[model samples]
Target: MAPNDSAQTTEEAKDLVAGRRRATRYIVPVAVAGVAAATIGLVPALAASGDPDLPKITAQELIEKMAASDTQQLSGTVKINTDLGIPSLGGLAELGGGSLAPGGERGESGSAASPDGKLLELASGSHTLRVAADGPDKQKVSILEDTAEYSVIHNSGEVWAYDSASNEAFHAKDDGSGTGPGKEREAAPKDLPTTPKELADEALKAADETTSVTVGGTAQVAGRDAYQLVIKPKQSGSTVGSIKIAVDAKNGVPLKFTLTPSSGGKAAIDAGFTKVDFSKPAASTFDFTPPKGAKVTEADELEKEKGLERGAKNHEDFKGMEDFQGLNIIGEGWTSIAKIEMPGGEGIGAPKDGEVPPEAEKFLNALGDQVDGKFGSGTVFKTRLVNALMTDDGKVYVGAVTKDALVKAANEGK
Candidate 1:
């Protein structure tokens, strides 16, 4: 082979390997996130023995009241538990740690590394989250781990994150101009979706189309009267059977969220406050000074460098790939499908004859079942609550829905 041809082949091989790794990074999180965020063990309130016949209300009224209810100030200890039903994949724990890629950490922006995102990434395990909120602009979330704690605090025009495990702290200043550390980090605070109200709102965004809401019954959550609002997907192909949320009757705050898969079984994800107080916490709860001798880093510089690197890579790899820039949502709500086109028809690396590189093929095969579809041949990765289909044509369709849902999406798109 000519020298130039040999170099091109070598580059293609490297790209192919990198592409498979990226795909693995992308699919693993999506599949796990489906269950990790919504499926948790029943909280103390819901687990209390004895079913008292609490007043029943229409789902519509409950939703309306919840919308009007206010829970701006409060303190609580939330418990998060998840069971994906698959054997322990050591990599699963890394999901909660941050980036899916090996050694990849999220940007330093307070918003990018939000507490909610971190909590959701945790693998199948039990965790405690302590939250205190004085108002929208003043709030703190601390993840309590064995012998260590990870805390994120947003207060007085500044954002601070400290990880006790490494004794590292990150700081960013919010100048109130929408360009501050927090705003730049998250782009939208609401995107974090940690609160009961926030989670309900997120699910409701896809109501009527992809899911139907109904009041399951009344229950006690966190020693308070609460109503169970059940959200069931309308799509027959979805793997999710329903999501049950216990909303505080007095204040409309969601006290607990539980998700069960379509295949009859126990809850896959359960999260809620085991202890809560409606009163405002002390002013010191939201304050942090970054213990002396702790290594502190300014997020602004880190984010700037990351942004530059991302921009350069995007320009280099996707200069003419305008069609792949946006994502298309095939459906809405719980069963919704997110379709993204790969830059090259064959994805990151396209061998001359359309054969997947041996290494890439081996990697994918180990992760999930390989299936053939009407659109083309691809692999289907499945978990108890989520499924994903990656086609040879460089298209990916994923959802917390069933494998049939993904296949249906792939067929329809074709």
Candidate 2:
């Protein structure tokens, strides 16, 4: 259940998680798609174990090794396979991605990859494959064929991704760098934190009470000696069911990662590295100067549409309709219009004395909060207790934003 906006319940935190979900499906996909930024070229980094013959180590130890690496510049692709996977409800999983296919609403892939967690740096030459096992959400592995084009760079406190195709560079934070070229891109801060260990600690804390294990093997990835590590969660929990991250044993750079579920499903990510250049990037790589007339807008600002926000936020107002009656609420526009209808009911605006029942009190209370005491005013027009709810959440009760659209849909339904 979504929390009320009054800051009482942890609903706002849920909203934040919801927002991250959208960003993943939208921003990450666009950044990782098909665009390579020039100016910056460095081979992906990996740690050189003091002793090559050392036995398998913990995931946290591996991350610590990553933190000490100085390599930069690499390129590759990855595919993730899984068997059982649950729909992402909280965090960035809610980006509305039913599947990784065309026409499906896309989300950012990086939401799953935070350098602050089990990672030090995600570079161009790095390839990661995630595999899962279980439900329909994890039936097959998604092969991210060629992903060098969407190279997101992070140094110190700055994050920048360059797309050569569009000649546009995006910054993770608001650094005022337009979506253009010639502007100076920020440098990797000297005191930047690269704590994969810290991130791993958080992961263990946030994770369910279960012990996870890792084993090691070898495989050839992009013609390199890659080390394979398998991580199996002891319990059947929703987070990090099972994961496999393969890193180049020679260079210690990650080659691929696979995440799977315990129920038996699949999701895979396979990254193939093409080149690893450790040379310093050109001076122009850090700049983000937009073109003369290229329009630029913040992603958050663009999502603030009145209609869509109203629809999503009020959706909770429409649940539990086993005994809801039918009455017409004041709809905007159109005279004598019946905006909504149910299987066994009529549409007359407002409650007809005893129309509303006590069971619906909670639902109506939610709506009243949105109305902000505007009910009973002429502006609110009419109130109704419909037999059918508009959404799965008992909120969003079911009234047309405009009388015209409501009539159109009702007629079309008939």
Candidate 3:
């Protein structure tokens, strides 16, 4: 190959890798939230240690056990391993990814390394979290990063989030009623999902659809015996091969979770507890006083300064599916492709000048292969589990399905 051609190929290879990261960060949280995040080549031997002999339980019984779990107080160390299978954006995180790739109509700004993009930071790589909850009113989660710590604590009506790297803290006061938009906004992403119980809840909800549920046997988790709840989609369109949640044999709390993609060699997601305690964490665990030098921001004050209505602005955010026009679910069950309209009737549009931004072009080119069909030409972002088709016609058809499945869904919609 020519030198220029070789160099161009190398750049495309990098873009492909980074674009996959962006896609997984942007899509998996929404698409595979119930199944698992877009896991790539992380855990080569992530399968359970060994299958232990345990009393057999029916799928319904296992479901009931998980649903009936009422352990409201506990603390644990959660280890999360995942790979988005895309290249790292390197510096393109500021390409307005926080809000746009997140599938939001609202605009928000942040660079990839900034703490403001904490939630987006969960998109790739491995993560370790310290999570504790005392019933519903008192909860705390600390994301332990390499050089920084991101902690959020909710004690009664006060919610405090502190980012050690940035030396900034944010506070929000809840209604104490533990419900409504305030509650939703506080716990939605701020908690940063630290336990298998969290994903297990979503998986069980998927079971409500056309899925098969069974017990895959028992295994050891956090030094406790756990029954593996195996869930598989009954349709071929879904890219998810199978889901396994290990439930505490005695209490039913999900102790470990794994998701195997349809094209899997090893499991994509392998999250489990390294240590756990059922005892209520000390009162100090939920208490927070911003460090001496940390700059603090109050949610209410910010809303007031911006002249934004709490009820209205927050309601729009949660009403994403309803407010995001042209979004439709094509097909049924786990194979469903959520069709979301590209913002501004453009494919990651640039300014009003009518030109594709260079960064945006690179982002798309790196994300996936180009395809042409009755649905027209578009980019297909592929991972182990989820595939998203960003059509030339300002629409995105995404789901845990194959590239062909996305095309078919787009065509069927057309």
Candidate 4:
């Protein structure tokens, strides 16, 4: 995105918006900004130091500066921390039938990245990411772990996601989908937020009626002087308290992004760089060669192998729920709730059939609490910023709003 003062820049901004919509499905949209209706996963970052000395700038100006930023080459270390307040992260993997991990479908043994893996890894705790970019077509993001690394590389229109521990890789061709690694994000697990800009882009997507934007002040992020652009929701019922994007004072690039929950203690999601470099990374940084023993899975092969497993999905793995009917959006803007129908039985119970495993059943029982409302009784999963209500009839309502909001949406169908 660039300065919308000119026609060229306006077009670029629209393009950026469209490009971003295509590139992402995650970090847990949490009924926030219409990112997802099923579940919201917030990506957190390390906190920045106190405010810094900088020239005064308005919120609109900072947004413009960030949109106009054109940093095409850079390398940096990004720290991702998320605490959605949900317990038993390993239960999430079992819910997915062990398909959640990036490339470790090989067996049910070993650490496997996470019990807990790939997308699950980004859902909580702290992760160190090595990121680099040279122009729109070349870039790399690597998640460094104790004994393994997961990486996503885009070079000359080819995309590769490799998991070192699993010794497996996923490969795809860009096909001119869109600029930024997110264009094909839904297809691969590593398409998560690796930079402040990526997470900040989500906040920018808020509808005008739902957002109130302002300049929070100045700060130093990754040693760079930056301006904080704060966005808050206008309506009631949203789980998000506010979003703060730290924009580099000089380059206009976003240096950090944090989303504080309305119930607020600590930020539910905080993401930013601890170290950064604007200079281009060496060409070798994007060059990737699969290890000899690595199993390479092509994009098409992966898609066919795993249906709906490519992205974070609702709990439809329960027995007798064959197809995920679809989603219904209730209300609008920040207060909106996402309604989806699950075709199975009254409750997420031990399946009479083997469609779901024992662990998944156990997870479902533990993750939610039994509750009854005007709409009826099912279960509810509550976190700092989002609430979910699964009705007895198999209707699921998710939103950043309160549990009452979800129940209201279920009853009124509004």
Better of 2 and 3 by lDDT: 3
Q: Please give the CA lDDT of all the candidate structures.
A: 0.75, 0.39, 0.74, 0.73
Model 1 weakest lDDT span, ten residues long: 95-104
> Compared with the true structure, what per-residue lDDT tens digits does model 4 show for residues 114-229?
22256665777778889999987788988998898888898987888888877877778877554544456444435553344443455455445678888888888888888988
Q: Model 4, poorest ten-residue lDDT window?
A: 107-116
Predicted structure 3, TM vs. truth = 0.71
Q: Write the per-residue lDDT of candidate 3 for residues 237-322, one digit (tens) a residue.
A: 78888999999988889999998888877777778897899998998999899889777877766546434534677676666545
Query: Against the true structure, what is each candidate's TM-score?
Result: 0.72, 0.35, 0.71, 0.69
- Which segments of model 3 are wrong by more than 4 Å? 1-50, 89-92, 97-116, 178-209, 305-325, 341-354, 357-363
- Predicted candidate 1 versus true structure: per-residue lDDT over 290-366, tens digit per residue: 89988777776666765776777768666567656567898776778888777657554223343768886676578
The alpha-carbon RMSD values of the candidates against the true structure, listed in the order shown, are 20.9, 27.5, 16.9, 22.8
Q: Which residue pairs overlap in candidate 4's backbone? A: 23-182, 27-41, 28-41, 30-40, 44-81, 44-269, 44-270, 45-270, 45-271
lDDT-best of 1 and 2: 1
Task: Please write out the lDDT profile of model 2 over residues 182-209, one tens digit for every residue.
Answer: 1332233234443556655665554434
Off by over 4 Å in 2: 1-63, 70-209, 236-241, 250-252, 263-279, 282-288, 291-294, 298-414
Count of clashing residue pairs in every prediction? 7, 100, 7, 9
Model 1, C-alpha of 209: deviation from truth (Å): 4.9
Best by lDDT: 1
| Model 4, residue 349: C-alpha shift (Å) | 9.5
